[model samples]
Target: ACDVFSIRAQTASPPAAATAAPAQTANAPGAPQHFGRSAGNGPAAATGLWDYFWRGLTENYFNFAGRARRKEYWGFCLFWTIALVVVVGAGLFIDDTMGDPDGSELPVVTVGLCGIFLLATALPWIGLNVRRLHDIGLTGWLFLVVFLPTIGWLIILVFALIPTQARENQWGPVPTGVGI
Candidate 1:
């Protein structure tokens, strides 16, 4: 049986193209190679708003190395805000429809759902904020600005609005389609 299989294999022949070596193009002098997108051509350019936001939440859930563009940061904020609103609405609905009169004033399901949502998103929230700061050429530690009181929150708001750095800095390369 082995001899028969070997004989059949030897008789079979691959196509000429498959057997031939692929043509290789030599780079012209000073020609760019393997360089990613040019300026103003990042993921935000190719993906929809929801995709950009979801990518930030899922892809960079724990990523702290790269720079996040304004779209990515704001996209997340938009989705997160909408989700929070929805969660609040659900909680209110649950409180109105399912809460026990004899139980504590607060609805247990509502509180539980809200708490779970916040806890689930806490890490991604922090990670995105840190990356957003990195995009503006500031260190992630700047997130501490949120802890300062009334002024600290104002500062954080300002930081969130600041545009992405046009050029690459200490963080990874400038995000595509950002600051262009």
Candidate 2:
């Protein structure tokens, strides 16, 4: 008698996982289920967003050859945005406290802080974009679509909203939490 492994075991490439930025967790066949917004049950579901965000900055900073679930992509974006706001706000406060003589002067402090923050997060965001593209079964090169003048970002937004593939792909297996 032949015992059949999971569909993922048959089709997903193990080597492809090496390119993934975040550590992968395997779901037990009869794992407990938690409802609402998470893909995992219990604590796994509760921390999924934060875990996804931190992993994007640390583990996936240079990872561009794998798949990313929508939750992961959005989690990274949400934190990046909050951090940007905080940095800019601090810069503005510092500039105000310093009391610039001329109101016409350029916002050096604001620009500098925001610039550094953007530079630091740029690569991770790019890698995220590429992996996000792969998640939806698109070529990573389509990331160029994000460079298209005014409409580029809009196009990418649509891409980001798309759900993950329901099965294993060339890049890897279905992300944890999603249903097959």
Candidate 3:
């Protein structure tokens, strides 16, 4: 009878392990006890400008399923802007250094290098934009707004500046700890 009662009780209630708090690591006195490695914690956090840019170019390259934080989008933009300036400056320098005294023709090497750089980065740029749109709770197809001229650029800029959704929508997980 006791065995039968014990078995019945065990089957009726959840196990103690299931109700217990998640295990946490011991930390020094007054130190913060980290639960897990989230986007906001540890050295792997994407908070840094360079980290956002490099991750977008590599880890998230061509990834269109998840949301992107504002920092990630803007960091990539900042990197692209700096790269553009450098590439243009280098091309101009090369042209000036190699061009003939008579400036009648274009600099082939400078044009070629700039063209190659633009071509190489084009897909990643599009992917970043798409993810940026996704961050703001919009579909990636809305990236076509870039083609509508002045207003389109303004719209896309607004979209990029907008904060990411605080929770996951149809898209994948939130990019930061601020959202669910």
Candidate 4:
């Protein structure tokens, strides 16, 4: 009778190993801890021009050459703004010179060229930002967060400049040998 009861109790019990797996894995030595690398090296590239600009507009992220300082971002913005203003102003000047004449091609060509140049030069920064996000252990999609304006931009800027998290968070393995 005792043997029968013991067998019944054993059969009724859940497998101890099944419940232990998750717990063991959580505490397991050498388990993968985090995702990305540290912030030592600077930006990594993604691809394409539109991707770059879109990322910048959203993320407030700007890093180049494996490490970008705040000064670099501001300086680049200033330079690009001045360049754009000059290019557009020149296009308008050409239009005025043409006196609204039909079939004048110079102004059209000038305007188109300026637009191309602006976009071309404005790209590349996007990839930089994506890499910066990686440094911070964030998804590249977070770049979109800055569209919220003052608060959103402020938040992103803070994150971009914050020393990259020591351990990886999510984006990828931490970058090596780059600082701040």
Candidate 5:
């Protein structure tokens, strides 16, 4: 009767192993730990948009030998555009204040400001694009395609939109924030 009771009890409920799997998986040594964050916000998450943008301008300004994931590239692009607009706006205001009473259509002050910004950012911009190409497992030399007549910018834009390669390439290991 005891044996029948035990068998019936075991059969009546779910198996012990079945219930223990989730617990084991939660405590498994090899499983990833999120602490309290959701899966997407884990430690392997990407850096902030501002961090990526500022770092590209300062820390990685001259760095061309490594890879740059998609987020880093786009972050730089977005902030660069914003900064450019701000600079131009400030220049326009200055020009307007300084009395352009001659009714000149040329925005000399704005043009000068834009030129300065362009010169200052040219190297860092190229380096970022180079690293972006490396992340895609392509040669940085391909960035020269931007010099093409009409299709150059379009090609570079296409390259920028391409996703990063999952595996590390000759440039270096997969960039941080990007998971294996």
Candidate 6:
């Protein structure tokens, strides 16, 4: 009887383990999560607002083909912003005729170019940010908080400071390093 009992126990344990194994390897259901993971590598991708702007506009303009990592997207925004300032400054300096005080056609052109650059830098991110929020299952209307001056600024600051949700979310999968 003891031998029979022991054999039965062993057989039960194997079946239990077999049942558990599938659950352990089971994939979770839902959209892929993509938050706070921007350290993979495939290609350098673009490194600024302008770079991503041109690329996204030309390639991903209307193409919501894949998810975008917030860190990389935001990082590009920062880099291009600095680059924009520097490039605009250099352009103005060059337009100044090596340090002339009088304003002229060159200055006008420089100012116009700077305005265009600023617009180009701002436009795409606005759309991208909305799309990002949409991926997170949030409405793009939240972006309007930025228009409220202090309130908007505070709202954006809070959003930026928060950690992105991990795991697959409604935004699909977290973007891989290739800036997909």
- TM-score, model 1 to reference: 0.72
Which candidate wins on lDDT? Answer: 5
Candidate 4's residue-wise lDDT over 65-174, tens digit each? 23322333444455557667888888778777767667555678467869786677654555555556666666667767767867987877776676666654445444
Write down the lDDT of every candidate, Cα atoms only.
0.76, 0.81, 0.76, 0.56, 0.83, 0.59
Residue-by-residue lDDT tens digits, candidate 5, 42-82: 35543788888898778787888888889989989999999
Give the runs in model 2 whose Cα sits over 4 Å from its true position.
1-47, 102-104
> Candidate 2, residues 1-180: lDDT per residue as tens digits?
334576657677777757676554546556544322244344543346778778878877888877888988998889888889999999999888887788767778999999999999999999999988888999999989887999999999999999999866777767667777
By lDDT, is 2 or 5 better?
5
TM-score versus the correct structure, for each prediction: 0.72, 0.72, 0.71, 0.42, 0.72, 0.56
Which sequence of candidate numbers ranks them by lDDT, best first? 5, 2, 1, 3, 6, 4
Q: What lDDT score is found at residue 172 in candidate 6?
A: 56
- Tens digits of per-residue lDDT for model 1 on 1-180? 469888988899967996897645436566444322233323434555687678766776787766777787778888888988899889989888876788778777778888998998888888888888988999999998889978987887898899888876777667776545
Clashing pairs in 3: none
Candidate 2: worst-modelled 10 consecutive residues by lDDT: 32-41
Better candidate by TM-score, 2 or 4: 2
- At residue 29, give the lDDT of candidate 6: 71
> How many collisions between residues are there in candidate 1?
4
- Which regions in candidate 1 have their CA more than 4 angstroms from the true location? 1-46
Model 3 compared with the native: what TM-score?
Answer: 0.71
RMSD of 4: 15.8
Please count the clashing residue pairs in each candidate, in the order shown.
4, 0, 0, 15, 0, 6
TM-score for candidate 6 = 0.56
